[model samples]
Target: MSGTFVGMPAFPEAARGAVHNATLRANLRHATTTIRRKRAVAVAELSDWAELREAGKQIKDHTLRHLDRYLEQLEDAVTAAGGTVHWAADADEANRIVTGLVKATGETEVVKVKSMATQEIGLNEALEAAGIRAYETDLAELIVQLGDDRPSHILVPAIHRNRGEIRDIFRAEMTRWGRPAPDDLTDTPAELAEAARLHLREKFLRTKVGISGANFMVAETGTLVVVESEGNGRMCLTLPETLISVVGIEKTVPTWRDLEVFLQTLPRSSTAERMNPYTSMWTGTTDGDGPRAFHLVLLDNGRTDTLADAVGRQALRCIRCSACLNVCPVYERAGGHAYGSVYPGPIGAILSPQLRGTDSDIDASLPYASTLCGACYEVCPVAIDIPEVLVHLRERVAQGGQVTRAGTKVVLKPARGHAAERAAMRATRWALTHPGAVRAGQRLAARTRRFHPSRLPGPGKAWTATRDLPAVPPESFGDWWKRTNGGTRDERGGSR
Candidate 1:
């Protein structure tokens, strides 16, 4: 709501408080369980859902590989059809282009459809700095706007808040933005929505400019698509006389057919519906149809760099469905703000460090936020293997070297936390490779099993501080198996 994401703490520090908040945990449990169940039902309806998911993954991969070509074609098609196209390399450039466009229209305010790209680039704050107000029309975004908070989930930005908190936000903050909530505002869903609708209605009508971000952009037709449960997206896309969209390059697909695949998958995966309640599709400006003038600012903002890594590139396939977030153990407990970026949860863990680089403690800590749980991969509609990317990024962090940022290369100064982990891992590797020493150590441990302390007393103390060490096995599994089977088991079943 403050339109800023500056000076946020790293993921570990931020997640500390979230893990202890019982109320936040309750809200997360209810929302994630409900969404996950509905998603399972919606997905079951499509018998070839796995195939569709694979298709989506391959299509995104192919598009990203040829991103430059498709982007050029998209720009050509949009410009030929009466829309102006601008290329922005980073958030600052994107914000500059959008603010300049709004200023050229001579409007002091603009209505907005929920767009993560816009949020990632901090467009609202940029507009406000330049004397233009951007009003969030989506119900969830409106709640975030009024509450002066950051969105924790991609699809459901205000998933962390419940009905009661929303009513309070409306009652307390609506007047400052536009229309005021009734004095007797209650926590009922209808009352909350009505308050928001009345509050945003006037802003939509009065604003001459509409700022939006697209879910997918079609290269073959230069068409952009935005899907939302609320009709506010349609209102903002249509009611304004002038429109501007800042879209990330990753949103593009090859053709209408490709768009169709995601349209089905995205809505069901994200909102648990057969189709979105309101789907807005527009090409370059249409005469007397939608906005009379149109401008699209194509944003890279570190996306190209992310596209370069083969293993990590799958993250670019994400359609912002947030299904991964609904099933993520870390996200459910830590909430969204801990991610320290607009993108949060599993997708954020992998995507943020790539986009922002691991130079900062927050970005570096993000990749390690999870318990290496694979739930995120199971729920991802686009088939993004989140756990794989998390491990890959972890390696990048541990290897200790330089990394490219934007276009400039910078040395990745190793963090003290990472250095310690690397040293411990090296020590483990050494011990495991020396079987003679390992066997002796196991025998020693078995001999002292009864006297083994409940907690570790060295550097391992930090790890054992909050946990009880598992009782050492009476004998190592290998020793027990060998003795029982007379060393003739063959290990064909494979060692654990």
Candidate 2:
């Protein structure tokens, strides 16, 4: 996990603050609602959406099943295409590799396309710590960088900020990083975009290095694909003398044909476009076109651990389209920062715990951040079944188990505060197994119903604080069943 999110509070604690921010909630609701509606329409245009989704699922599953072989093939293909491939087992190693590469270029600054991989590894912060500057060129990313804020969405990093907030960030922060925004910048979309464009153009022309993360990597031809609405990715991909892409190993597909399914699904799922405005594909470096030196850093960062879980591994099938986020009720209210990871929303709820493990407060609480309404699964292009994974992870967190961390298997203690829950589940199992005991307990509860408190005490206080405890029936259901011959029972314990 990136050091940037170290010491983040648990989800409930973080969400409490975000949930109160009326402006942030409004921004998120408006943006996500619009995206969701547009996405639904775009998806309806596809006649074979189900087939495309299934194909994508199968492709990812097959590639993951034989990841070792496919990754080697991908490495060979990349090397054959006059590019170098570096394997990073974790975030620190990945950052070190990238920093070394940038330092080797003898350049202090690099322009970046919006790359979740880079953000996940805290590459910008790493580069800055090493005395090198990394400029984000994507409009949303530029806004995020200028505001000194974390990305709140996968596609739109600045989705939490409205136009006015963006204008303020641009006017106040742009000069600190690079070229200043116009003296009188307004909140209009066109003006904000132009200000970002003019600010980035100088970096595009002068910077010798560029960094990015790929949407997909083709093993058969060593092709990397980046789908974006902004031309910033194309500019970053082409204008630099040295191009370095840090990508997750899970992003690789077996062939270009497999890439086709995602190309269709990703844009529609993400931007609600038939296709993104700019879809950039390149095979290493060309003689006189694009960067002369190209490098691909394949980052594992606990993806291998994620792949080892049966039910949870399906999370790797995510294409980062963020359809799940747009439709997520939790994300709409609590916003992205609550997840406490580079990945946010429903996908983050499942993906972050697996990637980072459940040892930390934030990671342990992530599984419970959702309503489990299955909206995320419904919208997922690859049918990731996010709710299922979330529940599975919850189980993992509730019960101590062996988990892989940094390629080493270690036993984890059950998360704190689950002792009461575990005891209750045990009591439930015992009662269910003994019919006589359940009947006796039911009768006792019924007889003692009048003494019951509306609010519980001790560990159960939190549960009852916001909810009314159900009143126990005057008689047991079993007693009523015996009296009524299973026909019906009235509220007064009379047979009907």
Query: Which parts of model 1 have CA positions greater than 4 angstroms off?
Result: 408-414, 432-452, 470-496
Residue range 333-441, candidate 1, lDDT tens digits: 9999899999999999999999988878888888899988799898788899999999988888877555567866677666677666778889899999998888889
Candidate 2, residues 1-496, lDDT tens digits: the string is: 1135779999999999999999999999999989989999999999999999999999999999999999999999999999999999999999999999999989999999999999988999889999999988889888888887888898898899999999999999989877899999999999999998899898899999999999999999999999988799999999999999999999999998887799999999999999999999999889999999999999999999998888999999889999999999999999998889989999999999999999899999999999899999999999999989999989989998888888888898888868999999998998899999999888999989889999999989989999999899998878877877675766566767
| Clash list (residue pairs), candidate 2 | none
TM-score: model 1 vs. ground truth: 0.92
Give each model a TM-score.
0.92, 0.96
Scored by Cα lDDT, where does model 1 land?
0.88
Error of 1 at 465 (Å): 2.0
